[model samples]
Target chain A: MVKLAAKCILAGDPAVGKTALAQIFRSDGAHFQKNYTLTTGVDLVVKTVPVPDTGDSVELFIFDSAGKELFSEMLDKLWESPNVLCLVYDVTNEQSFSNCSKWLEKARAQVPGTSLPGVLVGNKTDLASRRAVDPAQAQAWALGQGLECFETSVKEMENYEAPFRCLATQFLHLYREKVELFQGLV
Target chain B: KMKTDLCLSSEGTEVILATSSDEKHPPENIIDGNAETFWTTTGMFPQEFVICFHKHVKIEKLIIQSYLVRTLRVEKSTSKEPVGFQQWIEKDLVHTEGQLQNEEITAHDGHATYLRVIIQSAFDHFASVHSISAEGTVVLNSS
Candidate 1:
């Protein structure tokens, strides 16, 4: 089985459940902290996910960066040559969803001359009663941006693994494409 | 005593070893004293490089310019050879994002012939050290 490694960046506005989603995925829902300490810098976490029906696996190095506007410029350094992007947004906050485009632009700006594979995550799905962004609208935007969309809720452990699994699968596809191109050259 | 750039590559100071070396960003860039030129890491965490001074010197302070660096550990050795290292300073730096991490650390220590820097962790996969300048006076004592 082939093993691959990909650098995945989780980015969105502050308090949009970016950290919570990442923590839930990293700890496998074993730990969830109530108190929220603002992420001042980038937090690194690694997780390996097996592609469905495939013996291969992809180890994702997730770079969870702070969503504060003050730290936006810092994203340039932290987002260097990212293999995959997880653009997160709060379901209840309209502004957070609106800012997804800005975050995507920033992430794309880091790697010029190449298209980056990414996913748009509308987090806090458990807050459906207070949701401000309609799922159809978010999904439409994600599709326009050429990204697969997923909804997750760390509090409910709802679809928390879908986004990561999608990234791992896509990275494996990218790796295989590269190998094929090199083989054709030879 | 006049202060000089102790780690200047042009002055004949050498980088004895670097754990990871990229062809575009060589370890010599760390001592080049040019902020534009930088040395970048190619591998995992805990990357390091050793710099040998022309002679034993008292280090008063150090200024490091880098990008994506998180925790840095500095060690010094006074042996005739590049062995026997003692921890001199350890710092957890604040991330500045798009800008370079310009860190000025006070390193008051006795004469030492070698210095090693360990990059414990970075905010990203790769970290870059643009320049490292040591402001200090050379030791003239024969003993």
Candidate 2:
């Protein structure tokens, strides 16, 4: 049994459903709510998901962090252990989307050890009618960050599984291929 | 009536609370030149933190710990506009023994776009802000 630990960062505004999304992906019977108690410190939750083809179970340690400036000191600690990053933003708020660059910069500075793969999540997509962020703009921002972006609605569960599953799959695939290549050389 | 007061942090930018015991490392104190901050409820001690969200919000209860805040004020801005601000007066020392105390103040007419907390003048310790958690609720509504 291959044991792999995956770390994901849920970076977004206070009530943009970052914690809700993490809970949905990581735990069973996770409920979605309108109001969430703002995360003051770094919140850590772990979940195990099975890879389809390989049948290997990957344990994901998801960190839902506070977006306030007071918690900046803890970024290095969170970055040190994370294998993947999820840069979340609110679809209804353009400023949240605009701040994505700042959040990305912080994440990059923390994880200098590896080219940490990131997923741009436009959360609360169910409120797209009131969306201030256009898909094209969000996509362009993702391109500029050299990361893949997807819009998700935790309320409606739209494209919910795609973002988490895609990131997990990519990490597993790359790890397996690299190990095999190194073994063949040895 | 032995009542306990629990100070909690609200979600918004501007205005923070600090206890007398937490002076060395307050909430919004960033390191070096890197300005980064996070909001937290659980720490060494409990103090009430209030932030003025530029947008209107519905708050149910105002809970404070280890502190007796007599007046709660909500101002439009830092400018000295006396008309728009509101305050409440009370005489409750909510703490008996040196333990974590919790107080619940539910609002029947307490809805605000901005919030500020003023502890009774005798508490000895003041509040501190960690960092502003502005989620752009201001810009979107104004625009």
Q: Please write out the lDDT profile of model 1 over residues A1-186, one tens digit for every residue.
A: 665567788878889888788888888742322223335555677777889988877777888774544565676677776878998999999999999999899888765655678999999988888999999999999999999999998899999899999988877776565333322321
TM-scores, all candidates, are: 0.55, 0.49
**Residue-by-residue lDDT tens digits, candidate 2, B1-143:** 22211122332234444332222334443111112222222111233444444444444445443222223332333222223655542435443232323455555454455554434321211222222222221222222
Tell me how each candidate scores on DockQ against the true complex.
0.03, 0.01
Query: Which candidate wins on TM-score?
Result: 1
- What TM-score does model 2 achieve against the real structure? 0.49
Summed backbone clashes in each candidate are 1, 24
For model 2, how does the per-residue alpha-carbon lDDT over A20-116 read when each residue is reduced to its tens digit?
A: 8876665554332222333546666666656677755455667766554346566566555356778888999988888888878877765453466
Compared with the true structure, the alpha-carbon lDDT of candidate 2 equals 0.53
Per-model CA lDDT versus the true structure = 0.79, 0.53
